[model samples]
Target: MKFATTLSLLLLLSSILVCTMSTPLSRRHSLSVIRKLNREGPFVGLITVYAPEENAFLASNAFKPDPRHPFVDLSGRRFRIGKVRGKGVVYVRCGVGLRNAVAATQQMLDLFNVSGVIHFGIAGSLENSLRTGYVSIPKQFAQTGLWEWLKANGTVGPEYFAHLDIGSYNVPEGEGINQLGHIGYSAEEFYSESGVPNVPRRVVWANVSQNWYNIATKLEGMELERCLNSTVCLPQVPKVVIGQRGSTANIFVDNSAYRDFLSKTLGVSLAEMESASVIMTSVANGFPVIVIRGLSDAAGGQDGPNSARALGPLAALNTAKVVIRFIELLPSHKKYQDLK
Candidate 1:
């Protein structure tokens, strides 16, 4: 009886050990298997848009949603994986804010084998030369919404609202005024060494990937649509331009004074809501990013509020066309494989 009891205990212990070995923990012990299952590779393109109009344009042009294609629903956000110009691509409508843009971009990085990102949408023209329907590929992106308070003594104080600085009046000498209150306020002129309250100006800037910039520079003069339907049209034919700075924020700017400020202060050629966020996120992930914006309105230039409504569709369509052309020109996967 004593021998039989000892044998039964040993058998039970052996069964437990066998069960543990077949579980997930044991399967994870092999490094090769873990890598093979988790590691994602090969380049998949990521295209992001912010508004419904932009989404409609992309869906009709490059990304025709197919029910057969795999669709991923994560955390109440939907991502459609499709083919664009014969290349595997994913389309995401990130909504109209910095938070949404960043979150969606990060999700793409986590779930897909993304090679690069391209942002396409409409923007208000900051540069006088960029008229309605003109497309611009910005080289640098900045946040216009960020503001630092300036004390009477010419020193940095605290943060303040950016819109408070917009207007067409001079900051009176000691009237508790904002320097950017007026158009033609030059940072270089105000912040000289001999100027009052000597402090370095604060501005954060993010640059596009050099490889992507090179590709954009070569895309100039590409055909763009300038007509709004059969009857409506721009005053002049629009063309693609490259290598300019753009600003992004949540603000929908319709004030010409602020528009001039952005152009003069930051050399911003275009102003929009989502590109800067996407660019920064791409930079953090060490992937190439490009922003192609079509001029939808003048941002309160002489065109008035109806300008965007009248021209927005044309701008979105032209921007989409440029993006499609860029994708067609991207280096083939074989080139990347050779490097590996």
Candidate 2:
């Protein structure tokens, strides 16, 4: 009797999901459903990369018992609130780096189908103004089409609503912001153990170089499309920034060339394992992108200190709070309804 009743309820919810996702959905309708009861609040996605042994993700309290579905395999897992500000708002822990970030973003889109994605995590500020505790919301990103996609429709993707500056940058006053170019995306195994020839900091430099090359190619493609369309702005060149990033791989950090390049050519702020991937995924999907990093370790130098590990979580939490506030300040859809 009890088993039958539970099964019935599961079947009902499954039917609902199927119906909701059946049509060639509209972005506004998607947002309406996502923010339905919670329309009074902001509809957002909070994603986190769960670094090994970090266990920082478990700190969130948004986990709610979700009815398990074969299509959605979060079986035994519960939805935890990575962080919540108010209505239509929720956060998810999407493991670490490109793969994890992409998967998490996809899941959030498929499940809740929110209007915006606010990736709140820590990055190593390669530059100075983006200090140990400071947060960064880089406007533009560089990526490879092989691993991901970049938005070219000029309009928001079919699944999202806002097409607000998807690719651009506004480096905080003084952080070598002028020197910025295109943000880079690197996957695991991006560099080798032994530094490359002519490049003692092979690991760091390789990741940075590869990321820039990949992004340049992607941007060139977008520029080509714009020219064909004959838009007013024939080409849009993104200002890229070199920053410190946190990286996680089997190999140890042993290259100095990355630092040399950073000091000499790029003055980057931080480096981490997953940021490039995150930026690529967000931009491709037409979602607003922000790379927030907590200083973990200084690359190519003596293993600085374990302090970054402790400080990273706090930094991520701070970033989360700021994102929520920013959403609050954005002009609500109500303001655009009649005007649009």
* Clash count for each candidate, listed in order shown: 0, 42
Model 2 ranges off by over 4 Å: 1-42, 51-83, 143-256, 262-267, 300-306, 333-340
Worst 10 residues of 1 by lDDT: 183-192
Consecutive 10-residue window with the lowest summed lDDT within model 2: 220-229
Tens digits of lDDT, candidate 2, 228-259:
12332212321222234433332223345444
In candidate 1, position 235 carries an lDDT of 86
> Residue 231 lDDT in model 1?
82
Using lDDT as the measure, the top candidate is 1
Q: All candidates' lDDT scores?
A: 0.69, 0.42
For model 1, name the residue pairs that clash. Answer: none
lDDT of 2: 0.42
RMSD of 2: 19.3
